[model samples]
Target: MKKITDEQLNQYLEIRIKLGEENFKFINACYDEVLLLKKEEATKNIKFEITDFSKFRDFAKK
Candidate 1:
């Protein structure tokens, strides 16, 4: 199978919508899998360390 860039996902979805259900079902599954992979990479790279929880607590107290 050929790989498509994440940038082309939305464009492909738009085209898929105007197209047929059988084609849309298969392509939409691919699109969902790609979205999951992208989201995983995005969240994986984020540092979730709470370096200043006190500031958040202080603000919450106001």
Candidate 2:
């Protein structure tokens, strides 16, 4: 992930500090929950590649 600019960092800190610790905690929790849900939603079509392993095992190596 790219680092935020100093200006953005200053803005974010100002907003969160103004919101206060208690409110900031709630915001953080909600943000995390939403991010997880959004990630799950985004991967709805994800595919897994299945492979049989017996042929690639140690016994087959020789």
Candidate 3:
């Protein structure tokens, strides 16, 4: 995901301000999409540990 330019940010803010509250739904939708993308990107390099469940079998039985 590329970063948005300052010009683009200004344009979006201007349009959002002029459009008022009615445009909130659209803004929120865009925000959700961006947030999802960022979260996906952040997790791309994560290393997950696999837990061994055999050790817990006796506890579960008890």
Candidate 4:
């Protein structure tokens, strides 16, 4: 199995977010399916990080 890089994943995410509503839903569903495959195949380790956009906005006001 080929390793997936952070850049590749981010590019995919950006593309998905820019898609139309119906396409976005489809992309999300496919993402879930691919994640399962990645887990099973153990291609590479993946991690998720979340940030609060509101916090960034507050900081910008400073």
TM-score of 3: 0.42
Tell me the tens digit of each residue's lDDT in model 4 across 1-62.
89999999999788877886789888779989999987878845644346666777899999
- Candidate 3 lDDT trough over 10 residues, lowest sum: 47-56
Least accurate 10 contiguous residues by lDDT in model 4: 43-52
Clashing residue pairs in candidate 4 (N, C-alpha, C atoms within 3 angstroms): none
Model 3 regions lying over 4 Å from their true place: 1-17, 47-62
lDDT tens digits by residue: candidate 2, 1-62 = 89999999999999898999999999999999999999999988975445545645756888
Q: Which candidate comes out best when scored by TM-score?
A: 2
Write the residue-wise lDDT of candidate 3 on 5-44 in tens digits. 9999999888888889778778889999999999999999
Q: Write the per-residue lDDT of candidate 1 for residues 1-62, one digit (tens) a residue.
A: 79898879988777877887898888879999999999999889666558678877899999
Off by over 4 Å in 4: 1-18, 43-62
Model 1 residue runs over 4 Å out of place are 1-14, 17-19, 45-62
**TM-score of each model, in listed order:** 0.43, 0.69, 0.42, 0.38
lDDT of each structure?
A: 0.84, 0.88, 0.84, 0.81
What is candidate 3's CA lDDT for residue 3? 100
Q: What is the lDDT of residue 35 in candidate 3?
A: 96
Clashing pairs in 3: none
The global Cα lDDT (0 to 1) of model 2 is 0.88
Task: Report per-prediction Cα RMSD to one decimal.
Answer: 9.2, 8.1, 11.2, 11.9
